[model samples]
Target: MSKPSLHQYYLSLIPNLVSELFFYIPKNEIRDDIIEKLDFLNTTNIFNTIYVVDYYKGPIEFKKGRDNTRLLLKDGDLDKNMFNLLEKKSEVPPHEFNYVLDKYFELAECLFYITNWMNTNINKMLPHDDTSSGIFYMQSLSYKKHFEILVKNFYPTKDIIPKGNFNALELIETYFPDIASQYHKPAHHPTEHTTPTPTNSVGVQEEIQPVLKKTKKPPLITALEAEKILLEQVFNVDFKKLK
Candidate 1:
């Protein structure tokens, strides 16, 4: 049988990888709240658009060349619709916002490492132009802008107390030890931090539940779809070729 494409291989790995990284992030009240909010965001189509792509041309007129150079994250806007939703639902303190931002940064870094590994080992085997350069560049920009806005607004010139040491190898080892031992370099490490317990505010929960119930899709479906899109972008492989 022909071996799976580079995209297929990476796609198969992402859901577990993302889940592991997210879970391994040292738990704290702020992180918990962030997780809760993130969970809500994932339910919305706007979150998918933020990650996937946004249209450049709209009713608003744009300069001729500008329309073609559609940015992944336009004007450093991290989905204003989603942001507005978050604002309306939760009154997060600046410190907690900073805390959540730091944790989210850690998640982004973990994804970067995973993609970097794919580039080095797998992409090298494929045609040079077939490398995931363009896809990674755009996704990196999204990661940068999302975090940049958070830092500027919530923790400008502030020293963020890191919640814990993120030893990615160790995390993979703990959750998928055999996979880790085979694929990861040796080394790893968590601590719970004090933060406000989530009160499950009525507004956010109300918004979240309907979608979850309406779709009746399994929770893992989002992760699977996310993996499919990333793989398609990187390798132009059919999603069916994955998993």
Candidate 2:
């Protein structure tokens, strides 16, 4: 038989590896089906970032974009048209645009880094008894470790109760319930905090509650709650506001 290409081998092993990883994941933390869905998405190369709306259900959407995409950079520095297209196509709320974009970008960076590493090291990662498992094992371990760091650092104030060793979804849900409700309609009206109006009633110029500070939080996130903040503040996907 002809020697199988390294890429082909890596691709072939991904499914089984993903399955095994999912099997190791705690059930109550996240539905097996959801993990399967995520696996499918990753293996299929559909979305770079998978938004787990509800483990009991399915992903709300899969995002596509470069991990390095930045919002703060000038439009000329980026694929402005592409970014605009995503903004227009997305059902995300206006307020939550920056948050969502930044989160997805960060996630893309993580995934891209792993995938790129795999691609670069594929030659040396041939099938061997000790190292034959390929780079996925190490990649998965790194992902898990980084994921823990992400969870802790992102939501420092939130209470975190570990559901299980492998139940990342449960840990996420416990820390950020709003993310669980991402697919659900908003339950309340959008909160409006008033600021000084730019123009005075008499005509004098005054400060106005401009919508500049819609999002209020750190950008480095790894948990679903970070996703929620992005969706609500940047995308404006709040059900309450929609109603």
User: Of the candidates shown, which would achieve the greatest TM-score relative to the real structure?
Assistant: 1
For each candidate, the alpha-carbon lDDT, in order, equals: 0.34, 0.32
Top candidate on lDDT is 1
Summarize candidate 2's per-residue lDDT along 29-104 as a digit string, tens digits. Answer: 3334444545432254322223322223332332233121221221232233233424443544654543533343
- Relative to the true structure, candidate 2 reaches a TM of 0.22
Residue range 1-243, candidate 1, lDDT tens digits: 997543353344333223211101112212333334443323433221213222422222222233324443332344452253246325556655445445444544344433333333333333343324444344444443333333333322222424322443333323223333333333232122222221111211112222234345433223333433443443254544223
Whole-model lDDT for model 1 versus the true structure? Answer: 0.34
Compared with the true structure, model 1 gives a TM-score of 0.29
lDDT of 2: 0.32
Model 1 clash pairs are none
What's the C-alpha lDDT at position 206 in model 2? 25
- lDDT for 160 (candidate 2): 30
lDDT for residue 4 in candidate 1, whole number 0-100: 55
